[model samples]
Target chain A: DAGVTQSPTHLIKTRGQQVTLRCSPKSGHDTVSWYQQALGQGPQFIFQYYEEEERQRGNFPDRFSGHQFPNYSSELNVNALLLGDSALYLCASSFGNPPSGYTFGSGTRLTVV
Target chain B: QKEVEQDPGPLSVPEGAIVSLNCTYSNSAFQYFMWYRQYSRKGPELLMYTYSSGNKEDGRFTAQVDKSSKYISLFIRDSQPSDSATYLCAMGPSQGGSEKLVFGKGTKLTVNP
Candidate 1:
């Protein structure tokens, strides 16, 4: 089965700009979550999408938002990006509730100049 | 304090050695624990997961969870060079549909041949 897949493996954008990253969850999975991983750090949860609605969110600011399409694909949008936004954007998929059967994509490396 | 705490170790061990990685959490409500392995410039891949307290083994990897102490561990036996990567510990509450994961700073391991 195909694992979770993310688009634009790497991208560079200027500060104050906006960026959009995409993700396709693994087959048979319906929930999608987004995470941010800084260099030499573990990922921090951004938010989670289920049933096409954002269900839970982390401590991130409003500049970060996400959407889960009907087909279970997801998109993470970051507006007014700062240099600190330069990190690996990871997309994860799970069958239902997470902490089980969770899979992650290779992630999109966002570099804000 | 962070909900989860893990040593960001650049742990170097010779090949074929036994390696133990661990994380401690302050949240007792976290019922599901997971271990993820991430290579450089790549997203994390789930290595093992455990619900509540117990030990689960897959091949040379063993995951142990102690609910009373709120500690979790991942052990690798006969380690190989390919096992060199950052290991992340993640946990979430018992919610069924919209559980969000809290991750610890990853521990980097190097298995030198």
Candidate 2:
């Protein structure tokens, strides 16, 4: 009955440093996707994990990567953070169904200093 | 041009008024449409979704997708203060092949009592 959950509601990192954000998908869901939402802008797709492998990815650079565990929990890692990397990191969970809508977790706010 | 475009309005309205939110997409391949609501500092919550085209209503919210014009809309009736949030329009092709929600810059709505 629990919805998608994310950890480290807020984080701060400096240039050249890395940060990892965690997410636990909603119960009964298997696919996990990560998004980055900047202030005053909509989210940009980072990547998606299904069957413990990355299935699809967006236009993000190599600095962004993620993993999905067997339990359906996922983590997003960003390296060499820049000020532009500061944004709200959203974790959305969905089944592989065609019409399935994603259930989102309360995002982790990353502040690159 | 952005794949999806929306007016980032701090749209203000009175309680009980009808509110309309909209988005336009340039990608013709996008068939699954969705609306998500995000409160400040929170991840987006799925409001409603429509596959292909047509209208889908849930309680006070209605989502309309017009694929011909590549436009979509979300209407809120009898709006309440709790409805005040950033409404995001997201769309992409169904999962299993391409699974990502290309989102628009959210429209912020404020319903006053």
Candidate 3:
């Protein structure tokens, strides 16, 4: 069985531009959540998608958004990216209402220039 | 104060040495505690998890949680160079409600051969 997979292992974007990172959750999982991990720090929750709708969000600004497709894949979109937005974007998947434990992808490294 | 606090240490130890990592949380509501290992440029992989307050062991790794003190620890015995990575501590509330993991800054460990 395949674990979570993320596209474009590494990405480079310029300021004011927008970028979208994709993720396919592990098989048999339904819920998807996104996290931002800055260098030298732990990951911070961006948001979570369940049932194709955003269920809970962190303190992130509105510029960070996400979507969960019917197939349980997820996409994280960051608009008007800033230099500070450069970080590792990780996707985690779990099953059902309260995720027992999350399985995370390798993550997409976003570099803003 | 941050919800979770951990020392970001580039901790170095000789191979086969026993390693101990810890994290403290300010939120008493957090019911589940976890430890994740992340290699450079990779997403975190769950290493150990515990609920309630006790010790859970898996092979050379042992996880201990002290709910009364709001502290959690991960211990590695007979560590190897492959064990060198950043260890992250994460916690969340019960699964029935919103499940969002709050993570610590992570402690980097290097097991030198």
Candidate 4:
């Protein structure tokens, strides 16, 4: 079985630009969550998507948004990105019903210059 | 203060040594605890998870949660070089459907051969 997968293992964008990162949840999982990990820091929750709706969000700004498709794949969009946005974006999949263990992707590392 | 706080240690120990990693939280609502290991330039992988205050072990990794004291721990036995990485602690409510995970800053460990 395939684990959680994310697209563009690395990305580079400029300030004020927009970036879109994609994630496919692990098989048999329904919930998708996004996290941001700066260098030498643990991940900070961005938001979670279930049933195509964002359920819970962290303290991030409105520039960060996400979408979950019916197939359980998700996308994270960051608008007006700043240099501070350069970090590793992780996608984790879990079962929402019983809340099982999470499977995380290798993550997309974004570099804003 | 942050909801979850961890010592970001560049802890170096010899192979076969016992290692203890810990996190303390200020949020009493957190009901679920998790430990994640991440290598350099990679996303975190779930190591072990505990529901509440108790000890859970898997192989050489043990997770201990003391909710009453708001402290959690991960211990590695017979540590190996492959175990060198950053360890993260995450927590959320037991219900777990839409609850957000609060993460610590992570501790870095290096197992010297």
Kindly report the root-mean-square deviation of model 2 from the true structure over all alpha carbons.
Answer: 1.5
Work out the TM-score per prediction: 0.96, 0.96, 0.97, 0.96
Question: What lDDT tens digits, residue by residue, belong to model 2 across residues A1-113?
Answer: 99999999989888889999999999999999999998988999999999999989998999999999999899999988899999999999998667489999999998987
Off by over 4 Å in 4: B94-98
Q: What is the TM-score of chain A alone in each candidate?
A: 0.97, 0.97, 0.97, 0.98
lDDT at B41 for candidate 4? 92
> How many clashes show up per model?
0, 0, 0, 0
Where is model 1 more than 4 Å wrong at Cα?
Answer: B94-98
Alpha-carbon shift of residue B13 in model 3 (angstroms): 0.7
Q: What is the lDDT for B45 in model 3? A: 98
DockQ values, each candidate: 0.76, 0.91, 0.84, 0.78
lDDT string for model 3 (B1-113, tens) is 98999999989999999999999989888888899999999999999978769999999999999999989999999999999999999999634456889999999999999
lDDT of all the models against the reference? 0.91, 0.91, 0.93, 0.92
Top model number, lDDT: 3
Model 3 misses residue B23 by how many Å?
A: 0.5
lDDT of 4 at B104: 91
Off by over 4 Å in 3: B94-96
Top candidate when judged by TM-score against the true structure? 3
lDDT, residue A85, candidate 3:
100
User: Clash pairs of candidate 1?
Assistant: none
Best by the DockQ measure: 2
